[model samples]
Target: MINISLKLAILAAGESVSLFYKEQLEYFFGDAVAITAYSIENGSVFSPKNEDVYLVTTVSFECNEDILKYIPKDKHIIIGDVTFKNSTINRLKEFPINTKALLVNSSPKMASETITLLYKKGVNNIQFFPYYPNSMETYSDIDIAITPGETRYIPNQITNILDIQNRVLDRNTLIEIATTIGCDYLLDTKRFTTYFDEISNGGIGIETLIEKNSILRQQISTITKSEGIGVIEFDVNEKIQSCNNLALNLLDEDRSNLLFKVVQNIVLKEGVQSSKKTKNIFQTIYKNKKEEQINLLFIPIIKNDNVAYTYCLIRKNKDMKRENEIEKEYLKRGHYSRYTFSDIITEDTRLIKTKEMAKKMAKMNAAILITGESGTGKELFAHSIHNASERRELPFVALNCAALNESILESELFGYEEGAFTGAKKGGKIGLFEIAHNGTIFLDEIEGMSQTLQLKLLRVLQEKEIIRVGGDKLISIDVRVIAATNENILSLVKEKKFRIDLYYRLNALPINILPLRERIGDLEILINYFKKNLDLNFIFTEKAKKLMFQYNWPGNIRELKNCMEYFCCLNERIIETTMLPEYIKENIDLKEDKNQSTDFLLILEILNILKKSEKNEKGIGRSYILKCLKETNFEISEAIIRRLLQDMNKKGYIISTVGRGGSKITQLGKEMANNK
Candidate 1:
């Protein structure tokens, strides 16, 4: 048997158990074949010891895929780590060759959810191990309840168990388990009893215990207050137990005034109306008693002698906010009111030609269709076309079809009257078309709009007017329409998913933006443009530039922008070819290509011929070579090719070299080749 040891990790309520697990796993694994067990519920780590006993303070959900995400996925193991994401349950049995058995366990709720999600994801071959603390028959679905030093009594639930044997654990069951149990096991019976005993008595004693809880509350309060985040705590009775100042600040009142008042009036008075909501909220704090810093935790505290008093904690991590802020800053830079034509950038002569045509169509008040791949800047071009036309002075409205559903899109595009729906604005609202009445409206991702909405839009395009969602008023519109889609409209039309008449009306002055690969000539220009605007200084090496030109650019301009931004953040200086991702670097051949390179080299070889033929006028051809040199950025070998052709001309051979500054073909040399 493969040697395996297990370790148990425990922590006080509100402490992160993962830190201890992480430290221990790193020490034990050390880039070895060792399996590290992590409790995702409590964020704690577990490692195998020589003794084979695993101790846990609390029983939390564990899964194999989670272990793989942290370590290597292609390994064999008996016990699995737990994960909240439902996608991982199916692949557990197929881990490795040495994997003899797979153990799957879950809390009551997680069991159902995991099985359902897994079944939906097409996962089979899971052996169920339902954890019951008071069970001893070792059923196929029953595993020994996680307790300290109980490995000998525990059955190999994956292989030999009765109730949970040879059955596939699905995603729904895993989700149910992960949510209910969290990651850590609670072992302190005394603490559980103490909490339950105090809450069961149900005495409405107003004790000044805020000062006692203040120290514990301050830990989360100080961080949230300095960062402008919300933090609050509740007890088993769903009463406001404690909260940081920031939590009350977000509520626009203090803890003693607004926090307590809201809890007493709404949540507490309601008496846990939603069990699903309350269970999910309460389980995190109940399961992971060790976890202190929760990201948006909604904890529920249950108080009674039978069950321990529970605490609900909800938190949003500060790191995610910081990352979002950075992305928002970038998005803000390229956006203006309705994002008009000024945002599109292009130096391609063909695209410029297309732009001229698009602008003409825009000026004529015709419906225009823009089509291209996802990141090819279709919306930017649409905005630019609108701004360049006479509608520049008027409002330019842009709508995202994919962002809202049918009902919402209808309300957004066509004005809705007050009381149109349950939460409609009181006075009523102006539609996007109305906002751009005398100007232009751009619809982006039009393929995502429902067929019902498309039919309505076709009417708007053909009629030049619209009716409010609830009102019968036919509002006349002088709006120009520009629609863009990454999807193929013809395919959608063929599929009967989109209206053919709408496509025909919108197809007037259709513009197809060439993807980045087709216009490789513009790569250098775009790279330089991005580099100039970025906060850091980054240069591309010649090899790196060559790799850039070779990339297929699946994500188009957006990918390039993201890649350049990442490079800027990662390095201050040059981006070398080796530094690029593997796929980009693979096709790049820095070495010479015989046919193409030699032919180009022949042009530069001309310089030697000129030197031999026109010894006295050798420097005469230098200026001609200089022009070619400048074009090739002074790759001297190419200049020599032109010189060779000039020399051949003087020698009565078929060659071309002229110009007082350099080399060209003589009439006699041309005649010689013609005669031959």
Candidate 2:
């Protein structure tokens, strides 16, 4: 006699049943509670004896049609038709409007309803009977029979009936019940149909994302073997129906074993469970069959057509670097300096053409200067030039001229003897230029070098040698010099801040790297290149692109990269204009440019007013501003207008408010003008 508080769901569907079952488990094992029930289905609760256990009834209706509609569709229903048993049919009648042939696939609902009604009829025959739990062998030989007199006995003819009831009881335990029982079976119409209108709808709990590492591992293995890179499709069950060889190789798993295994097993390891903090990339895909269809770029596989498999193609989009694959490359040990010319990202036509020129000059020991805005990848170009040259076999060293003071710069560039300065090595310290002998020395921000140090560098370049700081020993060295700067060295020379001789020596061949905004023609190519190579979906709306184009990017290429990363962190597909940072959105115009010949200043004023207003207010405000300008006949200079406003405010003829201060038709000013 287990005192189990079993939760029986009578009229629930499959999804509801699953939830109910989960709740029942928590209610039981979570609190050390127990449950025992005659029927787990909704609307079926029976009690023959009260032996340390309580009996509870719950009504559940499983119907392809509405329960209320089904109840009124039939008339003159049969009461206790035991032979006409079917799970889909509602046996008990709740409504008297109509009666149809009732579906009674099981005797549990019918018997419970009949026995309940018969109790009022003074028929307690079945209700009072004490049916004890017994083995299958014992139940197989037993049967229940009602004698003509006041008596009941187990008979041989009812052995199958007893066995069936016992089996149902065994399966009806609270923790062991199946979803199909509550979802499909025991749809008694009597209690359920009556209560259907009264029950309130409360939604189920949020579903959790389970780990799927094993599945991903298998997919990776398949992709690796496929030897191609392209998009692939998988069904809801993660079955690979059709995929190009490229997509298959991207997954790197055996296609045969990968499909059979669940995605959870491949991506998330079997034993090591994932925590809630772990992001489920495939959550939307697994949760819903429709609308949740995923669009992900398979690793190393470019997803050209999200719906179909395609041929393998190498990603030529340099700016569109994928974080995941890049992370993999970065984490590998001891490969920092191995990055070559192929790794530099640039879409600038001038830069591309400069790189070709650099390649030809790499054979010579000629000094070169790469000039660009900060983050225009000057050092990157320097590295590529060094790596492509004959000095590639030698160690390539680099130093930032702006990062250190003159003293430290000199010590760092040239070696020091024992006790040369404070904390000098006992033996000696090797300078960067000495160590870079027979190699390349990349001088970044050469424009920031001090005039005094520039003289020493010029001496080194001319003499092709160096002298130690403490020791006067002259050490002749062979090293190629590559200088880079974000500043205008010619202007620095004019200001006497930089040595003219040093500038000429280093600026032998000046190459300028263009800013990102100047290469707007390559924006789409760069964006798509990143989309194809990266596992993310970062599509830009037309409005978002307009916003991007409107700004004068002070940070240049670096700012654009940061903005892209920021939006990517938000996991957005179509980056809308609204999602941009405040500075970008506030300063830039996201609308299309009209070709009408308006003065730049007037246009700027119009744009500012439009931006300050909301979407609904923009049009009205623009009209007002245009009308005001037309009334004035555009005669007033903007400066004169400002002076007039100041005078008006000083005379108390107009009042201005903070946050949004603008000139208006002041009542006193208008009265004074009318009087005149």
Candidate 3:
């Protein structure tokens, strides 16, 4: 024999109905489970000792944050025996349309919500009355009184009484709850068996349950019939049981002929089957009026230790073309830019000037080129420009030019015909340029595009039209192009790597974004912006802020946002210098050698300063170097300059001395400056 002992607690907010529930629970699970009732208002005083305790809440709305503190989350279940009944509404409709009826509930909010639902369902004749402690005495004129099961008070004047609690629960309900919570004694009760049979065989509440199931089935049928994609269902015997209208149309067969047909008889050509047992996708030729190649996805739904049914999604082999086109419509709506010129959080003068120029360019319908290093908010600028432009109401479509290869990129930009390629969509696919008509198409990382694609893109910019990859017809498009590149496209054009014509076409309105290191003064504002958006209550210590300002953010704003997210994940209210990312903390030690480091900007600045000093005949001393740096708004310590001068002299870039003469540019330094 197995030993079983479980403790169960019933919590109610000072309601007398909890005693009835406790009595019922003891009658059912008294043999194996010990039952206890507690008023949640007084609080739970006893803690279980080496025993599993399950708590049941009598009221749904009573499970507030305060109550949750005293209870284990997984140990509690809320069971409010409040359910909608069609029979109750049907009985109400038998009275006159303008007949006055009273609806009452223990909670005012619940009563209001139920009244609203009833009104929406065309039950406008009812007057709602929430049963307060003694408010039932005022409503003596009501013809019918409706109350939830838990409400103990009802006026005697109302002749027609419909109690929902009496209809919702019975002996079967308690037995099912007991079985669900692992109290098996309730399952074997003779009264439970009798009640279960009575309920299942068209008893008092069976009609309501059947009506709910029928309505749910109707909804499922409507969904299956209206969906654009083909959906077919098969029974466990692998025979077609039901199919949607789209599936019937795709198969070119009537519902009567398709029903009950085995799946093997429908396919003419076989394809590879997936290794997984539950779901698989493979190519096959279906025998409709003729042989048609399509891709079929099989999904088996398991129930009751068997495959209850299998759902099959069918698509033509050419559907990949339409897949992205359909997804683009949804993406255009959900992923539209929520950014504008005002959204760029920066106060740096250079970035402000760039934004001002971009705002002016947003007024014109010309191809704009945004140039910056990676993560310098190039895409952000593109979004802002589109959101502020004349085409603000239309779609702002964006594509990463480097993400796709040549063949896919061409089709995605220009679109393709139905029979243009082996896997082209059934009805030809509309490309991004066509979808983005009268709007803007942002092509990020334009320098990564091949020279061949560059020539085609140039044609589109010049003619405002495109021809599909394998088609001869020209499709006119009116989209504004905004191209962004991290590389210097002018250098690429000069080297014959990028088309010069395309560069000129896209450079109608050029904008250059400054990197994060150049605008270090804006660090605090950006940090606060990120923290506010993430809704995290965190403050960076002064040392942490100072370290962040000194570090060179190679990844720019994106990296800083990621660092803030990391701090938020740590659940720390105060972010200190030691808690920062390893790279940011290490940057403090690297600051002394920054001038002598292999940073391209620092190296180029040293060479430019030396070359300029040579022209002035004022040798590049530490003071003169500092003066030149101050002129360009760069502040570096004398120690860093001394280290840079020593390293450059050793590397044959300059000749320096500790005495009055300072440093002079060497032949190699002059050569390096000229090359740069």
lDDT of each structure?
0.50, 0.46, 0.64
Model 1 residue 140 lDDT score: 48
User: TM-score for all predictions?
Assistant: 0.38, 0.38, 0.40
- lDDT for each residue of candidate 2 in 4-48, tens digit (9 for 90 to 100): 443332222223333443354344344333333333334222223
Tens digit of per-residue lDDT, candidate 1, span 135-178: 43345433223211223334545334222222221122222222
- Model 3 residue 216 lDDT score: 21
Candidate 2 — worst ten consecutive residues by lDDT sum?
A: 202-211
Q: How close is candidate 2 to the true structure, as a TM-score?
A: 0.38
Clashes of 3: 2
Best by TM-score: 3
